[model samples]
Target: MTHTTLVTSIQESTGKTAITLALGLLAQDGDETVGYMKPKGTRLQSNVGKTLDEDPMLAREVLGTDAEMHQMEPVVYSPTFIEQAIRGREDPDELREIVAEQFEALAADTDHMFVEGGGSLTTGGIIELTDDEIAELIDARVVLVATYEQPGDVDDVLAAADRLGDRLDGVVFNLVGEGDHDELENDVVPFLEGRGVPVHGIVPRKQDLAGVTVGDLADELAAEVVTDVPTDEFVERFSVGAMGADEALRHFRRTRDAAVITGGDRSDIHTAALEAPGIKCLILTGGHRPPGAVVGKAADKGVPILLVRTDTLTTVDRAEEVVRSGRTRDAETVEAMRELLADHADVEGLLGH
Candidate 1:
């Protein structure tokens, strides 16, 4: 069977999921069938006291696959398991076995599999099994997504490249702060190249990712939206806290066409967000019922409301997916991103193209 795997490493909260999704979209531009996997995940949700390492829904979204979430991300080991394993109650090797099994499954039916790593290069309290181990296990090339602002990020990238040995493909310098393009091309690129690490691509900081459907954001955050506004317009910008009228007004002004995603139960926040001037919409997360008065006020103000049961971070994750995918430019930036990958990537060796 012919298969290619693209593994990405990113620091926590650096838009790794966005990049994974973009790569999946790009790979699909050709005739290639793609799959996705998150090899290491620390967050776990318990179902009937059984812990799952990853949120399967995330894998489904990133991979754009119909395969069951469990099948896509099978090597799940929660922090509890890690702690237990450390105490000798659970076999540490069991997690590795699970990941290997899933990698085998993903490899079986796809032309290319995009494997995403959890957190950054060293996360999950298991310093022993760096992302390098997963890359080695899957026999896949590694693409490092280095967050731009870290002071010693270059060192981290270089070290990761060194550890990947032959498996290291390239590095994508992501999350460039807005208006830092000059420093990136002149300073960052040349420095990395001088050290022999090929700079694959650089993703600019985009504000549009804040524009995501209110309902989708609620779904991820597991929250609820509680207004009559068009769910679509509720896309982008979420702030959690006292949803007072003042805060709502400020957020609406500070963010471009943003929605205040908060809890409906908090009448103060709900009412405040509704009253914000030119507010796009108000999303009530946490699945709480919005007070009737708040609902009426929202209607009067012509703002929409949605309800979901997820926390703040999950809400951000879903909203991010919407924003990142909503306004993609197949322009010079994307082409530049691809060129960097092709230049450093061992494409001929990995995919035989």
Candidate 2:
């Protein structure tokens, strides 16, 4: 029998996919044949004529799962899918059938198959399918990933545990801030366990895990990549250089791996950034090219200079998107997540449950 583990969250950005991938990597490392599948893909990308979700391919590369992309993530909802479903043009039952079939195929010859749900428990209820319902369909044990933002957040997990009943396996508290560690260790875990919900792990927040690299920034902003300086260098912070050279220099000095967002014409800020340490790259906004001397200095310092057409504020907002997007594809981040699971997560309980 294939042991199936379903990882879901109350809302998005709770590190569901990261936890799922961590567990899958652990299972594979133990010499177990691990497989992965995401039923309803929200991060859709094209592959031939079909839409492939990012997680399945990511799992295949990281875990060495034999499951192909099409089989693992088969049913990708188009933009108009929900509209069609409500208008009686799309069949919910048919969607469930495809999911069931693909899931079975992925499970064959595998010791453990991880079923990661998108968004939340009530995510796909619009199309008459939810994580709990899918859990029922595949007989998978459910694990909820909760964000440790506030003290009242435990109620969400308790409510889900109440609803999922016997099928609910446990909970993993993710992105626990420094302030919440004591509460998670002394209060939250005890409270949840007292309420009949098992607490498997509490992962502390790491800035590196939340960072986005220069390559991703360029892609996110559609900026022109003018130079190559470790595109993989993670930018943990962002600074807008609208101040004088001395003020901007001081601000840039305090931040590590900071992306200086300024206009292309601001040679003052440009000169200051080139001389600053921990500078990931310089983002010149407003379609104005920096002076040749400034560009030469950046190139000399081996820092990439991305020239974008968007204004300073809009460019900063797009840069913020990269920070919000927690991508686990980076080698550094993968190792960090693996360490978190190794130290905190209950691997034996999660697998043998």
Candidate 3:
């Protein structure tokens, strides 16, 4: 049987890694084994002789598989290395062939693998070995991820699609902004469709990427937790709704362990926080007052209810940055991340019985 491969590429700093992980999880839902490989990457530090994958640690957690980082990210051209190769000290084609060999070996073992390329599609034109050539070498299907924010972004993405030609399977327009999801549906999605690119998925700019706690974030960023809840038992997952008690309760229960962070004036969310069985803590973002009844219930249930005045989206964004950093590496956090990966990532789908 032919093992399929999915490729994700985007402009610089467009959160390609984030998109890859989320999609990898979605693909896993169909019970497909998803291996992750980065054929090219930004040069990251290695442990003496150990080469590591430049993707996020959470990636391995999601896939639940073990391979040498060097094998996973086989072709990383550092600045110094690039200079050397340019000066005829190193053969770029030979290096690429070696990397491709490792990639093919891994691809042969998996049912479907998600390979993420660094930056834009044709970034590494060094010695004229472009990303397109690399994709051709591996015989993988390409998926373009573009953030629908900058003017002419669609044009840029379409141009990329044109260059990729037959290797391109489809495109996924990622609306990576603080704007409404409806705007993407109304404005952006149609634009990509007109260009004949299939819209695989549209992910609204989530305030939080992986569910991580405020205390854990504070500890990581070394920022103070401007809330009442103890930092230890804080929850990270969230589904925000305009302050309605019924909606809040439903959102709270939809995910396993999460903190319901909302405005203090959102009495409905506060009430739901008090009642939610799965809630680890209640973060009242933007320093609003909780209803007396809601406060009383939270106290009685021994659930920590916190209050902060920062804007809701900003708070979540900061929290995600902190969590991704190697700040809170306790047993619980590690285990939680690992569990999430095994349950949701592409490797698990392909590997799990």
Candidate 4:
């Protein structure tokens, strides 16, 4: 019999995909065949003239699964679908049937199957396909991934526990900071376990794991890459060069693998960014082309220069959004995730071993 684990998160950007993929990897390492599916697709993307969810595509690439994309993502929650459901034109029973059929087909030949939830546990509630509802539909165990930023964040986990009840096999805390680790272990974990909630893992926050490539930032902002340097470098964080050149130099020096955002005409800041250590890319705003000297310097230093039409503030906002929406595209990030889970998470407990 195939064991299905539904991995959902309390809120958005809580590392659900990362944890799900890591679990699948662990299962695969144990000589078990694994499959993955996302019942409701929210992160829409167009590929080869077909609209599909991004998560399943990433899973197929990572796991080398043989299932087609449509089988992996049975229903996509597009704008039209959401509108129909809200208008009572779409039948929830029919949607649930579709999801069940796909789930069965994928589980037929695998020892373990991972069903990733939408942005949150309550996602698709309008259509009666929330994470808990889907878990009941597929007879799967639930694993919630939560982000621990403060003491009060435990309330969300408790709430989820109340909702999921016995179906919740465990919870994994992802992206936890170093300073909060002690409190989580001593106080929060014990408190939750006392309430009959299982804390499976506590993953520390790593800058490389949360980073985005310079190319990803450029694509999100629709910026123009003016230089010929490679844009594939991973940017751990972004710095705004709004201050004086000297101050910006000091700030840039403090950051590693960072993208510096400044006005294109600010040649002083541009030059300083190139000279500073760990400056991976320069995002120039206001559509102003940097001076020839600045471009030449950036090119010589192997840093890509991106020109954006928006102001610095808007550009920074878009860049921040890109970084916040982390992707597990590269092998290094996947390896790091595996190591973190191996050291911190109880994979056997999560798998009911």
Candidate 5:
């Protein structure tokens, strides 16, 4: 019998795809015939005219799975698909049949299948299918991914454990924010274990590892880049220059490769950031371009100025979304994740070897 694991997340940005790919890599390292599948999708990447599943590509590249994208993704919740499902126009049985057929094909000549889940436990509820249902359909154990970013996270994980019950294989804590290690290691892990939720791994927060790029901010915020800088430049920190130039400069200088969000009319703040080292870019909000002197300074300092038509509050929220949506296909990042999970998670235990 082939062993399979279904990776799911309670909240977004729990590094679920990275974890799934890491497990797939571990399986390959053990000389197992690994295949990948995800029955449903929400956060997607565009391909041609059809919506392609993003998670499988990571596993495909890592494991060299022969299953094509259509087979690996199985079903993608496109806009038309969502409309059809909501209007009761699509048959749930037909979808299930399609998933079953594709899964069997992918399972052929494979010793292990790695199935990834959508954002939350209730991801496929609209289509009358849940993560548990998909796991049951494919005979895969559930691995819930959680983050210690919020205290309510504990309640969320416990609730998921209660819901999945024995189907839950283990919990892996990923992307833990700063200063919460003590609580997660001392309080959260023990509490979950006491509640019978097997805690498997607790990955620490590394800002650089989770850093978003200048191009990501531009894409998410719809900002126009005023200077041509490396769009792939990773922003490890973000700061707002709403304070005095001296105070803002102190904070900005302390952050490595940080993006400063401020009004374009704030020449003082603009000048301060331009003078600071390690400042990746400036996000000028409210549709106002910085003064020519400030623009000249930015160009001179090799900093990109991103101008957005929206107000400061809107820009900040969008920036948070882009940063939280961080998932990198970089080779270094993949190797780092593989090493992290190998040390933290018991691949051998999960694989039943």
Candidate 6:
């Protein structure tokens, strides 16, 4: 029998994908024949006239899994499919069987299979395909990834343990603030262990791991690149340049490797952003073109400027989503994640060694 592990999270944007990728890489390093699958894909991308899940495609690229794209991601949560399921036109048993068949096919050739779940444990509950349901279906162990924002976040892990029961292998706490590390290690971990929840890892918040590239932001906002500079630079944060020139500069100075979003007509803000330190990219909104001097200066500074037709608020919202949903595409970020996992996470325990 193949050893199967299902990696899910308490909620969205909790570095679930990063954790999954790191664990897969660690397993491969151990000379284990590893396979990957995402039973239900929430994010859709078009490739070769077929809509596929984005995460599984990334897995194929990074992990070099031999499975075809369709097999890697068996079901996509498209609008039509969701509507049909909600209207009682889709059969839950049939969908579950399809997922199980795909799982068995992939597990046939591998010693270990890493199954990635949706954004949360309850993501596919509407169609009867939640994380716990799939875990039971495939007889896979469950590892819950939860972001530790406050002391009460442990409640979410306890609830997940209750739902998963004996299948709950452990929990990984991600994006933990630096100051709270001692508290989590000293207090939270022991408390959870007492409650029958194993603490597998406590990964601190890393800016590089959480950052999205300028190209990713452009794709998310559908913006036009006005500058010829490279868009591969990582944007660790973002600042809104709606204030006066001096105020904007002061605000921009506080952040490093950030994207500045403001009205394109705000040449004053644009000039201030270019003058300020750590501005990686300029996102000009409202379709208004910037002055030639501002564009020339940005180009000279090697900062890419993105032009979008959306308003400042909308652009900011989309940019935030990109950062939260960012993938582990960069080599440095992946290496950093591997190191963090090695130091903090129990790789052997997670892989059932």
Please tell me which predicted candidate would have the highest TM-score against the true structure: 6
Model 2's lDDT to the true fold?
Answer: 0.82
lDDT of each: 0.62, 0.82, 0.61, 0.89, 0.81, 0.86
Report the candidate with higher TM-score, 2 versus 3. 2
RMSD of each: 6.9, 4.3, 10.1, 4.0, 4.1, 3.6
Question: What is the Cα root-mean-square deviation between model 4 and the actual structure?
Answer: 4.0
**Candidate 2, residues 294-334: lDDT per residue as tens digits?**
87788788898999998999888878867766466544466
Weakest ten-residue segment in model 5 by summed lDDT: 324-333
TM-score of each: 0.61, 0.79, 0.59, 0.82, 0.82, 0.83
lDDT of 6: 0.86
The superposed Cα distance between candidate 2 and the true structure at residue 128, in angstroms, equals 1.7
**Candidate number of the best lDDT:** 4
Global lDDT for candidate 4? Answer: 0.89
Across residues 1-353, which tens digit of lDDT does each residue of candidate 4 receive?
99999999999887777778878888899999999999999888666867788778778877889799889988888888899899999899999999999999999999999999988999999999999999999999999999888999999999999999889999999999899999999999999999999999999988767788889888888989999988889987789999998998898898888999999889999999999879999999999999999889888999999999999998888888788766664445666788899999898988777
Q: For each of the candidates, give the backbone clash count.
A: 26, 0, 10, 0, 0, 0
Error of 4 at 299 (Å): 11
lDDT of 1 at 95: 65
Superior candidate under lDDT, 2 versus 4: 4
The TM-score of predicted model 2 comes to 0.79
lDDT score, candidate 3, position 196 = 74
lDDT of 1 by residue, 1-353 (tens): 54545555655655566566556656777778988777665445676765554434555654468775566666455666577667777554776677788778877888888877776776534534567777776777777777667546667777777767777667776657656667777887898889777776676654444245555555555544555456555454455645456765676566556666665567776665655564566656666778788788877777767666765566656666555544332233334444444544443433434
Off by over 4 Å in 4: 213-262, 265-282, 290-306, 310-314, 330-332
- Give the clash total for candidate 3: 10
Q: After superposition, how far is residue 62 of candidate 2 from its true place, in Å?
A: 1.6
| TM-score, cand. 3 | 0.59
User: What does candidate 6 score on TM?
Assistant: 0.83
Candidate 3: the clashing residue pairs are 32-349, 32-350, 33-349, 33-350, 34-346, 62-341, 286-308, 286-309, 287-308, 287-309
User: Candidate 5, which segments miss by more than 4 Å at Cα?
Assistant: 213-233, 236-258, 268-280, 285-289, 292-327
| Model 4: worst 10 consecutive residues (lDDT sum) | 325-334
Model 3 / residue 98 / CA error / Å: 1.2
Q: For candidate 2, what's the RMSD?
A: 4.3
